[model samples]
Target: MLDIAKTAQLTPDLLRSFLVAADTGSFTRTASLVHKTQAAVSMQMKKLEEDLQCLLFKRDGRGVSLTAEGEILYRYSAKILELHDEALTAVSGPKLHGKVRLGAPDDYAMKHLPGILREFSVNHPQVQVDVFCDDTPNLSKMLDNGQLDLVIATDNVKTKFSAPLELTWILPERMDPSGLKELPLALFHPVCCYRENGLKALEKASRKYRIAYGSPSLAGLLAAVQGGLAIAVVTKDTTAKGCRHALPSDGLPPIKSVYIDLRFKPRNRSEVVSVLGGFIAKGLGIVI
Candidate 1:
């Protein structure tokens, strides 16, 4: 049996060193970052290997690469560091005092996010929130530029890192598709998940459809649909408020909603992001 006491005694500093080594692909560079001698870094790594009884790295031509065990340990180390950072920030701050610029796509912003934000605001009364309603691609760009701290957007473009949610189709109420060959549709602008999914579904089924109306805002799309223009596809949670599902009858395709986060920058504001993200996840019943 493994020594429970020894496992419990593993330190965060050692984990941090392990991650730094994995990231830089060199014990020397990792030692420089951690202000330790190269020999000391190598010793720590050897000690870690002994404790775990696994080879964490293998020396290549001139550098080192992670073994399979090393790769797994790196992933866990990153999560540990992330959680540690969040905990430190939560206790270090005066209730997140800052203007947190947040952005969301119009559909979700209107339908689902309000309740989550409401609960967040009640909990952190000191935070000043500035929200922008826009398309997913634009919102993602803003997040990359640090113009916004958090964003809730549909999965249109692929990010190196992201959290995804499943999406569904919504159609007109009590509509029959007995003789329908094509669908008259309302869609959001480009790079929106609903728009992409709708188009893909039609193409995959070889169905012909026309853009009856296109809108940048959810309100505009809903207005056009309600005015007897066409049907729109949206997240299940967003559409459950008013619209009904239309698939299997019209042969429309099904889609999923994906939530993505820009992890390019490691900021001191991650705790706030995590708290708000948790609210969103719980509200949507998905872990993105």
Candidate 2:
């Protein structure tokens, strides 16, 4: 006879935390991603390990990495969560049926939007998510003009829904910026946060730099950077394969942190719009 009382059951919360930890390879980062304290995340992982009666993580100086058992669990955890969400939607209520006009910068649309949209579609299969890619200033204008139901913008002072984003200096793998007296840069237009912040940082640091290439498109700027025409300041997520970060030893000025802001019209906002907005914010771990 089996002792059912002694068996440990896996819960969605624990699996979610574990999945984040595995993906990030850091409990601290996982804590931030899941909106929990580091200690709380640690406790959850400990409980999960105890429940499974197996070691799932190997801790080292850099961070934690998954063990063999952890790898196995990660695969199943993702499927389980997917099915979990699917099951809830199937029984919860009538599926939401509407259209959500979403706008984002091209960079974010490529780097971050896909997974979030995929999850959203799973929950609300009938809802149509229309994505428009443009610069932040243009996206904000569209949102204000009621051309878009929701938008993700680079944060400014008045932003209410925001999340932290890290910026990095991206340079071609074979090129070094330190050797040049006047640093060459591939930058966006004046309205862009990357352009404004990067130039400001270089000026404040008394570094001489010139706009070697300028474009309104992320693809064009990345091409310039990848071709070693110039370095660029961009969000950490969008660094290309042939590029590397400008390290402290590279003698480049540090870029400041920025925020991803979510915007929506306050008046006459439909329930579906609000739902999509909340979903995006939550997906990005933005605090309302």
Candidate 3:
């Protein structure tokens, strides 16, 4: 016989955590994405499995993987969560009126957010969104100062990183990384994650480097790289039209990709923030 009582107790929060863990394939990452502790995530998974009466995950040193039952749950959780979110948004009314302050890098603001925001606006025409486009560091500072409600920024901290975008080296397809006296780099402010990581890696490798082009605008960085002015460090998710693979065949030391993260400030006490967070996760199908 089925334990209908146990099954009935499954909550949306647990389902959301499970979804995040499934998407990231790591409990630690799942916690970061859901704003929970690692222990809390583990306990939630344990409780969820107990309720369903099945082992849902397999854990090893590499990370966690789903059991066959887990695969089934993952599929259903996505659909169930989507429906749940839809119900909430529906009840909340399409004429949801509120102002949402959002910040993101120029590249993402240009390429990625438009479709998501357009869809959001279509659903909630009364909601107003003011977006700021700038480098991650500056945007992060604004978020900290409570001038922004939500921010998507490049993150160097592995623990706090959550965004799915891959940060990589974007250089001219024709340029070579070898035999240069000082590696020329087109980058954002030194406070930026990509610039910081790239420089640290190069210095640790004892390679000479120079900032060949510096700009706060992604357009400037793309222009410099496309014109063959210099090699730039940028997110691969925002891969410009004229660029080659990162450090292709140059035998340079491997550079790690910086994590892009969505962060909410403590002062952002708005129900719309929660609603939009759900929208970004469900509507855009991002783990966030």
Candidate 4:
């Protein structure tokens, strides 16, 4: 048991080497990052696999790549390192004291993110937040341009990381099913994930539909829905009051909400990125 604990303690350093190696695709680069020799890094990785009883990396003429176990370990190691940094930040106050420009879809900003932003602000009062509410593509562009430090947008453009949400179609309470065939759809602008899914499902099912209304803002969309203009697809948590779900009748596909973050280079890279990433994970209910 004592030996097991000792081995477990070494696992993090092993993971560190593995992550660096995978990123650089070279044990030499990993060795430089860890201040160790290439042989030392290789030995640590070998001991890691021995301790876990699993192969974590595959090496060949094409260069080294992560095995299945290595991919899993890398994902968890990133999270572990994130939490470890968060702990250090909590103990070492004011590490991230600067303006943080964040972007989110209007719906998330209006409905799902207030409590999260409030909590984040309370925890780090020294950090000032400026928020932009926009469509996913616009936010992605802003993130790419470094105009935004962090963004919370529906997954449309591919990014290195994303968090998932469960999406559902919502309608006015006690709405009649007889009008299902001629259902009016509420939608955002083109390129929105929810709108795309909703339209695809309708088309796939051959359900006759028309756009009764559209809005880039959640408040406008909900207001339109409340007034019996149309039904809309949105995340389960983001649904407003006075609305009920409109489940697919037969062959329509279900939709999933994926929240993707753009990787931005930060001025205070470690501290700012750490807090922003942690806040995002906690907001999305991802277990750190």
Residues 154-216 of candidate 1 have per-residue lDDT tens digits of: 565555445565566566565554356667888887767678877887788677788888889
Off by over 4 Å in 2: 1-94, 156-158
What TM-score fits each model? 0.58, 0.70, 0.62, 0.61
Location of the lowest summed lDDT over 10 successive residues in candidate 3: 279-288
Q: Write the per-residue lDDT of candidate 2 for residues 113-222, one digit (tens) a residue.
A: 75477557766878988999988889988988889999888853546688788888999888877888998899998899888889989999999988989898888899
| Best-first order by lDDT | 2, 3, 4, 1
Name the candidate that leads on TM-score.
Answer: 2
TM-score order, best first, reads: 2, 3, 4, 1
Best-matching candidate per lDDT: 2
Clashes of 4: 0
Where does candidate 2 clash, by residue pair? Answer: none
Candidate 4 residue-wise lDDT, 162-273, digit = tens? 6566677777776764556687878887878888877887788678888989888777778878887788887765544567666655333566555545445556345755
Task: Kindly give the number of clashing pairs for every candidate.
Answer: 5, 0, 0, 0
CA lDDT for candidate 3: 0.74
Local accuracy of candidate 3 as per-residue lDDT tens digits, 1-288: 986574656577888788767766677656545667889999999988877788999975536889999999899887887777678677777756799999888876765565467456646767888999987778878988888998876676643426444667777768787877788889888777777878888889898988888998788988999898798776654454457757556745566776666778656758887677666554323474
lDDT of each: 0.68, 0.82, 0.74, 0.70
**For every candidate, C-alpha RMSD to the true structure in Å:** 16.5, 5.3, 10.5, 14.9
Candidate 4 Cα RMSD (Å): 14.9
What's the CA error at residue 280 for candidate 4, in Å?
A: 2.0
**How big is the positional error of residue 56 in model 2, measured in Å on the Cα after superposition?**
21
